[model samples]
Target: MLKPYQVYNTHSLSLCYNDYLLLQLLLCFWSSLFSLCLSLARNTKKILYLLQVAHKNSSMAKSICFCLQKLVFFILLSAIVSHARPPQVLPRQEPSYLKFVFNATDLPSEDYYDYIVVGGGTAGCPLAASLSHTFRVLLLERGGIAYGKANLMTQDGFLSTLVEVNAFDSPAQAFTSEDGVPNARGRVLGGSSAINAGFYSRADMDFYKNSGINWDLKLVNESYDWVERAIVFRPELKNWQSAVRDGLLEAGVDPYNGFSLDHIPGTKIGGSTFDSFGRRHSAADLLLYARAANIRVGVYASVERVLLASTTPFSGSRQSAIGVVFRDSNGRYHHAMVRRHGEVILSAGAIGSPQLLLLSGVGPRPQLSAWGIPVARHSPYVGQFLYDNPRNGISIVPSIPLEHSLIQVVGITEDGAYIEAASNIIPFASPARSVFIHTPSSPLYLTVATLMEKIVGPVSSGSLRLGSLDVRVNPIIRFNYFNNPVDVRRCVNGTRKLAGVLRSRSMEDFKFRDWFGNRDFRFVGPALPVNQTDEDQMADFCRRTVSTIWHYHGGCVVGKVVDGDFMVMGMNGLRVVDGSVFGVSPGTNPQATLMMMGRYVGMKIIRDRLRYS
Candidate 1:
């Protein structure tokens, strides 16, 4: 694939750096000239004339000596420029495949690495990548390579098939308890981060600051930047629209005016634009860079419990976590012992992490008792506050076309995330932001919108329980979403606003209603926001219809269930470092927050490990 300039430079190997640089420049000019002439279909006569004109200029009284000096200079320049680039190394056997047979006994193999980070998806990937440099770290994942699979993880900015491929496909098929919350967790290598709509944003700073860590926006300022640097995640609403922006301004709900390229739903209500063509990347791509540097990763192994050296006392109820015991696909159980000199971090996501804790005998009494599981250490808070950001799709068959194209465009404002499609609206949000709105076009498609308010209050609490080692029972979720009269009122108002937008757009005026029209969401429900009094109607819509955006957080929290530093409050050597410790839902997407917590906890655990090392 070498260009003409590169070929010319390759021949100029005897020149100094400066001379070589100059040689390459001239060669580039000549190559460009030749290409331009060829592209223009210039004849041999025209090409000859062009060269003659240049030759005449360089001749300078037909002086051969001057021409020789110019030719030498060009060769020297080429040599230097070509040498400046790094030499491409040819392929060879990868170093990571080596088996260092030094651990005499089966003491977990001198794979007795300093750090063994489980789950290289999302938070785990970046955390492992960053820490691998400081120590011999092993990242364990359970999915395939994220990208390069056109069918599964495409490079184009589109939702990958990974999300749809969960442990269970349907709500009925998925395990559930009395609550009936279908567990739709991504079991892919990238985890949920691979299949999501590339939405990104921060939660309310005050929430994190108020949590037991005493972290305020100002104190965690560097933490935010650190996250951005580590990964390219940005706000969900990275950009905004003129109508949306002006509308928000008129409504006195403006945040800042910076814009972005993708559209994460429920990102505005006064802030920047959303990501338009969503960001879709596999965690494997990020970690592969580290893998090139001696880091190791394992896939397809189900981590069962953390292994601690205390038969006299179960580890969960007392000190910190040491290591882990996992069962491979072959049903063989193996333990990675961190008896000392290191640390074990639990990046087993919100849904998985809490379930892991409960299995390790560290949760509430009633739930564990029901499962015939003995409580190693009774921590009333374990798996007590299960939470997830709910989702609902409002569709309007658009008058215009709906092309699920990559390289998308989005607009932001004081409202939430907005897609440009005519009929369908996909927004990711929670009741916490209390944001809603509606903007309609010639609705062959629909233009659903939002203006959210802070929704996740403390009054609504839930619990996560284990049905078996492989299954998490129906999580006892009690969001009390409609409990807030104000929230209900906002939903009603949002509906009204949507109606208004639909009324004003071309579809109505142009009589495109036959295709774009929608039957208003009025049904048999108590919680319907009819004067915010009909709680039944709204509750019906909330219950039967809404799906989770998968932003689960705070079930196995640090302060309530876990400890101040993320160690399961009563557990020894075990720490949960995923999106399950939000203390309170931040009313935004939890991917960025999950990553932050992962990196934060990963480093902290490593710091402690080094302290002991």
Candidate 2:
């Protein structure tokens, strides 16, 4: 008989050899299949005809093809499972423009600039960067910097960053809508862009044609290119994302557009702000393009209100925004005034812009009086027309381990609904850890993947009002989700489509087989209704599960609060140039267009100034 240790070593070696051989075979098969696919891609019609004929004949060739396809998929799945976890330690680097950024506490009691841009978030960063090329600008942010924060800088930490909220000074600020749905907003320098899923897509053509602002198409494209060159990257699709893409096609989302940055009707892979090494690049990076000497960025600078003065001595004369009063982190107040012919711009997002305007006494006269605020301008529409796209979806735990992924592939349906997916690892308490015990138990986590849908251009809307005298407090708002019949119908259709995706052949491996041999998905939360055709049940599901995708907009909208030029109505030296001016949300994700708008408006301002000078 062989010795016990010798027997164990022999068995381990034998298994290792078998695994090595299998890996080599898989790699060879995958390489050959990839080349074949590339050739077929050049002539799609021929490939489709071949597939059709094979299906009709049901011959040996069809069987061989099916086996080969399954083998390739298995190989890809194995690779994904082997490397599902991301690296724990990544190299973090600070941007060169940090030299130009300073803490608000260090600023003088009073300062002057050619332009004062409030809220150094998504739009404000690019806007300040663009203006710095030709004019002096001051970009003030109410939050701290995003760089050097690991949670905000890595793809694996996306969810963790959003949940780390506090009463003050957290990267994310939490709030609940009057509709009873919980939500969070970015309180960092990059705004939502720093904390979002990193999906980057341009606005739809209809957005440009319908928006009240007169856009220069050439300049728009140029601005997009500028942003893309700095941050956007083509994502590497893994098994979960690849399966979702195939499932979308199988469910008839149709005409796979492949990898693209444009918003088109089909299943496509969109650009991401996270690079290949899993590091994120947010809108704050846009400042690298700015002329550092001409721009000053102050973090932890919260503007209390716009300083408005009557342009003429007579009463009823138009009031102009001459400056702003802001408080630093140390509680010291400072005045940032604009020079002659200078402007004060508000890029303070949809929520912040309107709330600031209301606090400055620019809303309805009666409402302001009730709040004990003197009316600076009687702009009745300052806090009206608030909207947030309602997101509803289902989450499931896969039978096989899956990698963590953010929004990468998007399925754009022709019926005005967009579908997306994300997989995340969440830590939860184990049963062994008692609530009263001070000692912690071993760490346990659950991997949950989601398939979600949101309707395009929701017709239902609501309003916002003041909640507190403190500027840091969240405002009272409600986005009456699914109030319109049209939105409800769209949600019903979208949910049914998700049901189809769950049933697709591409999703078969992810399902769990019960003792009776019935394969079904193990849902993490609520599952889709069995009778998808029941519109009432589907609509009820939508209403109950409705949540915000954080794509809210429209308070200081165009034609009501601001004009086509983005200037505040009946107010001189003031302009609102962020999502607040958007009458409708653009494309699937608004960060791409929001950043583009910042650059676009900045260029327009420069051109107008130069021409008149």
Candidate 3:
């Protein structure tokens, strides 16, 4: 132990000396290393923070770009799709007469045919064909064609469904009257000819003889063959075995002899044949043939009004037809001057023809005044003497089955005076519906029909007038359907007798229902729904419940309102051709009569008037 201060100084000096150059260098290096480490750690932390900021900015930029792209795509897609659509528009509700299956192309103003016939209906169909060969004819129809629609083309729709009636398929929102039935006209090209069941027969000859017209059975009989060939009328079944027929036979009813088997009477008896369309053909087929033969047709052009010639060409009467004013589907108005002095035949048919005449000032003056229509002339018989098939009907559940439900049976009055008796029977069957696929073989249901030819038919002729230039107003029809005592007696007896058949032990196998199926009249015609104690009570029911079977006729009777040859009597160049020519109801199905009228008038026009003119 040296002195304390001296020893410390010595120890310091010795330590300094003992620390070598390498050690000194190492210490310096270690101090630098620590400072460098601290700097690196701070720099690394700053670099990491900078990288995190870059990542956040980049992600935000990408999200902004994505949103902008989506907005652009949405705007472009919406604009493109909005520009695509079809050119033509179709009608929402079709016309009632569309069942007639008529179609036509746009008629050019360049078309200048000699004879222009209005309407393409039952009578008009054959008439068009007959005259087309000799003349340049133009047939104008107010409705579209039913070519592509299956229900009309193949007759797939049911015959008995109320769809066949004149009412709109949609129910009315507000009714205008107590008996607000929607009476209507056929709207398709062929008018009512397309959907009819083709029942064939003529009315009482007495009706024609008694009417002031110069008509007789001799003239009618002579023209029968010519008409049959055009229409092709023949019974689907020759020797029948239907229950209704059998029932009538059991009651001693004879085949309708007014003409004797109006359908295809055996050659030994008359020696003629016919086909499905009453006799041999349908109006649609006939008109199509005419079209193929190069006859021009125009459809969906409703004639707005007749544009008469400003100058007169007749004796105290202006030119019969100067030109016709009409309209197109676009609601644009148009006109067609009769082809260079060519005459127009007004076959607008029934309601249309009379309406046209009245609107043009050629009908009953007083009635026109009451309806607020300006009267052109005071022709008294314009809408007079309307007639239609007086349909007599009753339902029965048949005990027997028959092939081909349409026209499965027929019977006729045995005596000249059928007023005291109810004889003959015809039956129609409803189509097979439901998954059950029931056949006529089942004999489960049947409906029998009979017609009263002579009765108190339509008393007041209905008038079709325009409320405005374009709107068709409701027609005024006052028909006392079964007003005659004879009609009442016939129904009561028929119903009572038919009721007996259903009740008969023979018909025990069949089921029956009527009056909405409330009272079961099993077999025999249930006694008339009306109290049968007297005829007046029954007649009242007949008038109330009976709606038209849609066989309207005679409102525009040819001889009286027009002429014996169906020429508009007062006017020069127009004519009427349709069921409306009948003075009273035809005794049988109106199909044959209509065809005959068409054929007869067509031939007459071609032979006499055209040849002479």
C-alpha lDDT score of every prediction, in listed order: 0.46, 0.83, 0.48
Candidate 1 lDDT, 1-613, residue by residue in tens? 1111000112111111212333354346446544644654756675456566767676443454443344443343333222222112222222221221111122232346666676666678767766776777766654434333332332121222422333532111133334454444555555666655444555555457566664434424444455555345333321223333344434333343344322233213221111222224444334543543545566555677665445335433355556677655555666665534556777767667777777766677777778777676677776766665444324322222222322122223223322221111222222243122122311111122222222233234566666566632334444433344544444444443333333332223212221123323211112224443355665455445544445566777767776677666655556666777766665455666665555566556556667976
TM-score for each model: 0.63, 0.84, 0.64
* Candidate numbers, best TM-score first, in rank order: 2, 3, 1
How does model 1 fare in lDDT?
0.46
Candidate 3 global lDDT: 0.48
Kindly indicate the candidate among 1 and 2 with the higher lDDT: 2
True lDDT of residue 508, candidate 1: 32
Estimate the lDDT of model 2: 0.83
Worst 10-residue lDDT window, candidate 3: 6-15
lDDT of 3 by residue, 1-613 (tens): 1111100111010001112332353344335545645665778876567556758797755554454343433233222212221112121233222222222324554446667777766777677767787777767767655444333432212132214333222111111212333344566555665554444455555556654456545646655665555444334343222334444445545443332435321111111122433221346456644534436556666775665553553456434665676666666665666665566666666667777777776677777787677765677877666553234444432322322223333343422212111211211222253122256332112222222222323343443433444423434553344445565555555444444333444334333322233334322232355445565665554554444556667767756777776766766677778766666655445656676666666667676756777
Which residue window of length 10 is worst by lDDT in model 2?
Answer: 6-15
Order by lDDT, highest first: 2, 3, 1
- Total clashing pairs for each candidate: 91, 0, 27
For residue 360, give model 3's deviation from the true position in Å.
2.1
Error of 3 at 567 (Å): 1.6
